[model samples]
Target: MAREVLAGRMGLREAVRVGAYADALADRVGAARHEYERQSPESRAGEEAEARRYLAGLRSEIDAERAPSRR
Candidate 1:
């Protein structure tokens, strides 16, 4: 995704920044999933739901940024 966003295009600085953001988000999602799995059964259900909601929001943000803008 970051590669697509940066494709053929960015200066070194911009590419680095984009890469950092992608890495951070990936780490966050991984940590969240791991934590969710480690929770008690009752808590796991709520945490899993929250993780899904957060992931959906992340997807929406990515899609919105990638979409072509209106003039």
Candidate 2:
């Protein structure tokens, strides 16, 4: 990507900066979201449920991979 930027590839540098900015923004948002969720017990429960729902599929896949029988 840096090579492409140095090779006079238009927009590559800006694109990389934009992607980096987006990643930083996402990290900030995630931190703020967790902090917001931690502010109230009820809200924390709701947020945890929402997180579990989101992660359920991935968790199932991972559990399947790590199942004791598989080991």
Candidate 3:
């Protein structure tokens, strides 16, 4: 469970900062997994391909969300 003692005391900006840290941790974990797969010769090519596709999809989704609507 998350320790919410400090969370109650934090302001909105601080809470967003905490969330940003959590997002960063997720990115780091993904990078670590990619690296581990990269080090294995047999699975390396397939893993790298998967990682590229995953990242491309994520980027495209983020871009779409950021884009302004035509209406």
Candidate 4:
């Protein structure tokens, strides 16, 4: 599909540079994955909090795309 090809190209570039806000959003999600994989918190509460934070970020990005931009 078109998405797969586009994603593949972005991955190849290492950092896709989706402007300022989107770049920060992508970094946050990547950091969350790293935290979970490395078990950085070592507690159920911390892990759950990280998960919630990441989900909230995803929701934010979705909302941003769906709404009109001021810029």
RMSD of 2: 9.0
* Ten contiguous residues minimizing lDDT sum, candidate 1: 8-17
Q: Rank the candidates by lDDT, best first.
A: 1, 2, 3, 4
The TM-score between candidate 3 and the true structure equals 0.45
For model 3, the local distance difference test gives 0.74
lDDT per residue (tens digit) for residues 1-71 in model 1: 45645585555556546767668777989998898678899987887799999999999999999999988
The C-alpha lDDT values of all candidates are 0.78, 0.75, 0.74, 0.70
- In candidate 1, position 43 carries an lDDT of 88
Best by TM-score: 1
Clashes of 4: 0
Per-candidate TM-score against the hidden true structure: 0.46, 0.34, 0.45, 0.39
In what order do the candidates fall by TM-score, top score first? 1, 3, 4, 2
Candidate 3 per-residue lDDT, tens place, 1-71, comes to 02343556665455446866668767889998888866867677777789999999999999999999879
Model 4, residue 52: distance off in Å is 0.4
Query: Which window of ten consecutive residues has the lowest lDDT sum in model 2?
Result: 8-17
lDDT for each residue of candidate 2 in 2-69, tens digit (9 for 90 to 100): 55566777455474577775586678899998888668888778888999987998999899888878
Report the Cα lDDT for candidate 4.
0.70
lDDT of 4 by residue, 1-71 (tens): 23534777555234444465457768889998886677644575776888999999999999989999897
Q: Once superposed on the true structure, which residue ranges of model 2 sit more than 4 Å away at CA?
A: 1-38, 59-71
